[model samples]
Target chain A: MPHISLPDHLPGITGLLEFSQNTAAPIRELTQILLRGDNSLTQGERELIATVVSHNNECRFCTSAHTAAADLLLGESETCEMVKYDLDNAPVSDKMKALLTIAKMVQKSGKSVSPEAITNAKAQGATDIEIHDTVLIAALFCLYNRYVDGLASVTPDDSSFYQYLGERIVNHGYTRLPQGYDHLKNS
Target chain B: MAYIKLPDNAAGMRGLMAFRPHLAPHLGAFTEGILCIEDGLTKAEREIIGTLVSKLNDCQLCEGVHGAVAACYLDDNEVLIEQIKEDYKKAPISDKLKALLNIATSVQKGGKYVSESQIQRARDLGATDIEIHDTVIIAATFCFFNRYLDGLGIDPIQDSEIFRQRGRMIAKGLGYAPKK
Candidate 1:
C-alpha cells in the first residue's frame, strides 16, 4: 500500500503526479523539455540516459517505464537491456558509452564523478550542452527514483501497462496525461 | 571554479542554470512551487528541510544558501538554524517538524529507507498528506540540486555574509528565477 492514498488506476510517478497537480505542472514541463525538447541529443538518447540512471538507482517503476520508452524510441529492446546488464559491451557508440559512464558516476555520488570522466566525454565528442544535460538528467532521475519509492507509490507488475505507458510517452510526451484520469485524483 | 565554462558573474547553481537558458525557467518555477508556496508547511520549515538534506549530502553551497533562507524567515535566528542542522531531533522545534525532519533524514540515506512507521509517526504528530508529500519532494529535490552543483565541481562561496544577503533577497520572494 502507498503511504498516502493515490489513484489506483495510475501507477508509479503518474499516480503520484496526479495526486498533486500543483507541483506536477512544473515537473511535467521540465521533464518534457529535458527528454523531448529540441536538442542535439535525440529524444531516444535522452530516454536512454534516464533508463541508465533509473536502472542504477534500482527504481523498478522508473526503470521499466523509461526502458519501454527508450525501446520504442530506439526501435529496439535489446539495447536497453544490454545497457542495463553491461554498458561496457553494449552496442551503443563510444560517445554513448562515455556519457553513460558519467551518468553512472553521478548515480553513485556527485563527488564520485571524476575530472577524467568529463575529459573522456569531451574526447568522445560530447559537447558542453550534452555533458550538462547528462548530469542534469542523471540527477533528476535520482529525485524521481527517491520520490516514487519514498512514497511507496504503486508499481504495477503487469508488463502490458508499461507497454501502454511506453506508447503514450513516445506519442504524447511528458507534459499531459491522458484524459479521464482527472477523476481518479483524490479518490 | 566549476569544471565547465559557466558564467563568471553567477555563483554555484545559478551559474549552471545560466549556462542552459532553455531549462532554467522551468527549474526555477519548480523550485518556487515547492518552497515558496505556503500551503501546509511554512516556507521556513521547507527551507530547513532543504538545508538539512544539503548538509547531509555535504554540499556546502546549498546548505549555506538554503540555511540562510531559512534563517531569514526565522527573523535571523541563525542559532536555531545551526541547532536544526546539528540535530533537529534535539532542537527546539515542534514535534510535527521533528517528525518531518526524521523522514527527511531517511530520504537522504536512500528512498527505501523511508519506513512505514516513519510515516505513521509523522501522521500521528498532525502532519497532513500534503505536508508529508512536500517533505519528501523537498528532500528529494535537494539531492538533485546538490548533485548537479557538486558533479560539475562548482566551488562553494566561503563568506557567510554573501549567503545572508542572498537569503534576504530569496526570502523577499526572489525565488529561483534566473538572473537576467
Candidate 2:
C-alpha cells in the first residue's frame, strides 16, 4: 500500500531508496558515516540511539531494523529491549543512560534538552563527540523514520528478514547495499 | 547560558558550528547540497519550504533565518512571510505552492501523516514529482536542523536585521558553509 510504486522485494527504506539514486547515494553515505563510521560511540550504542528514537516515533520498520543491529553488537536482546523500554533502569553504564536521556529529549524537542542534561552526560564521561553523535543519531533517525513511514513503505511481518539485514549491515555496513533499480529494470 | 562551550557571538546552530569547526564542513556541505544546490525547486521556493517547516516545528530561530533568506528572493516582503507562517493554506500564494506547502506541513507532523491525497493534490496543481520530492526532503531536513539548533539551547536573535543580512548572504550562494 505504498503511495508510490515500489519493488516488492526491497522492503521499507531499501525499496524506496532503490527508486532514486540521486538522493539515495548521499543518504546512504550519510547513514554509513553516522551509524557505522569511526566514532567513540560504539556502533551498538549508535544503533541503540536510532532504535530508541524509532521506538519513540513508533516507526516499526526502523525500530525493528536498528533493534536487530543493536542486538547483534550488544549480544543481548534483553539489554537492547531494556534500553528501549526504559533506559533509566537498563543495565547499561551510567554514561550510556545519560546519553540516552539526551537522545530522548532530542526525540521530543531540541528545546527540551536542558543544560542539566549535558552536565549529567559529561559527569558520566560523555565526550563532546559522544554527545554530538547522540544528537545526530537521534535527529537523523527522525529523518529516516519519517521517510520510510511517509512513503507507506512495506514492512515484513517476519522478524528474520530484519535480522538478516542487521547482520549484513553489521558485517559489510551501509555502503554495500544495492544502489538503484536501473539494473533491475534491464534484467 | 550555553551548555556546551560556544563562540560568544554565535547563536543557534551557528554557535555550535563555531564550537566544533571540524564537523561544520560536513553540515555545511549537506545544507548547501540541499538548499543552495539548484534543482527543480527555485531557491526561494526551497527557502520557503525550510521556513515553513521551521515554523511548524516552532523553532523561531530557524523560521527567522530561512524566512529572511526566502524573503531576499521574494522581494523582501515581510508580510508574505508572516502570512505564510500564520496559515499557509490560506496564504496569498499560488495553488501549486499551496499544495506543496500542504505536503511540507504534513511532513512536519510526521511522514505517516502525509496521505496519498496530498501527493495527488500537488500533482493536480501542476507540481512535478521532483518538486514534491524536494519539498519532502526540505521539510524533513528542517526537522533535523530545527532540533539541532534547539537541542543545544542556542538562543534566537531578537534583531530581525541580522537575519536579513544572513538571508542575503544565503541567497547570494554563501550557504551555511560558515564564514571563511
Interface RMSD of each: 0.8, 1.9
> How far out, in Å, is residue B89 in model 1?
1.0
**Cα misplacement distance, residue B161 of candidate 2 (Å):** 1.2
- Over A1-187, each residue of candidate 2 has an lDDT whose tens digit, in order, gives 8766777777888776666555666667777887887888889989889999999988899999889999999998998899989777898899999999999999877788988899999999998778877887788877877778877789888998899878977897876445433443423
TM-score per prediction, in order, is: 0.96, 0.91
Instruction: Give the per-residue lDDT digits (tens) of candidate 2, residues B34-83.
Output: 78756778888889999999988889899999999989988888889889
Residues A4-73 of candidate 1 have per-residue lDDT tens digits of 8888778899888888888888889999999999989988889989999999888899999999999999
Worst 10 residues of 2 chain A by lDDT: A178-187
Against the reference, the lDDT scores of all candidates come to 0.90, 0.82
Which CAPRI level is candidate 2?
medium
Candidate 2 has a TM-score of 0.91
Best by TM-score: 1
Checking candidate 2 for backbone clashes, the offending pairs are none
